[model samples]
Target: MEAVFLIIALALVLMVFAPVAPSDRARTPLRLRLARQLHLWDRYVYHDPQIWYPRD
Candidate 1:
């Protein structure tokens, strides 16, 4: 029972400090590709198209 408790504590500690694995395509500091940047720009602009394209 003590060994099981210790194992669980070790696992919890490891999970707390585990280095993030490199499986995410959206990792930090990722440079935006041209198309992705354009799409992002579109989403941004489209999010409030009226702000940029006012219908005054």
Candidate 2:
């Protein structure tokens, strides 16, 4: 019982913290998905303008 609980907890932690690579170009962490949904992920994570914007 204890081992099962520990495994579940570990899986949950990994799921929350791990970075998810989608089929598209972006790779985002699960924990920051809320911020991404709110359009604040890049603002807080990428400080440089060049990171979010590219030169044309």
TM-score of each: 0.34, 0.35
- lDDT of prediction 2: 0.60
Q: Number of the top candidate by lDDT? A: 2
Candidate 1 lDDT over 1-56, as tens digits, reads 79976875575555444544467644443233334445655686579878678897
lDDT of 1 at 27: 45
Q: lDDT of all the models against the reference?
A: 0.57, 0.60
Model 2 residue 24 lDDT score: 81
- Worst 10-residue lDDT window for candidate 2 reads 36-45
Candidate 1 Cα misplacement greater than 4 A, ranges: 21-56
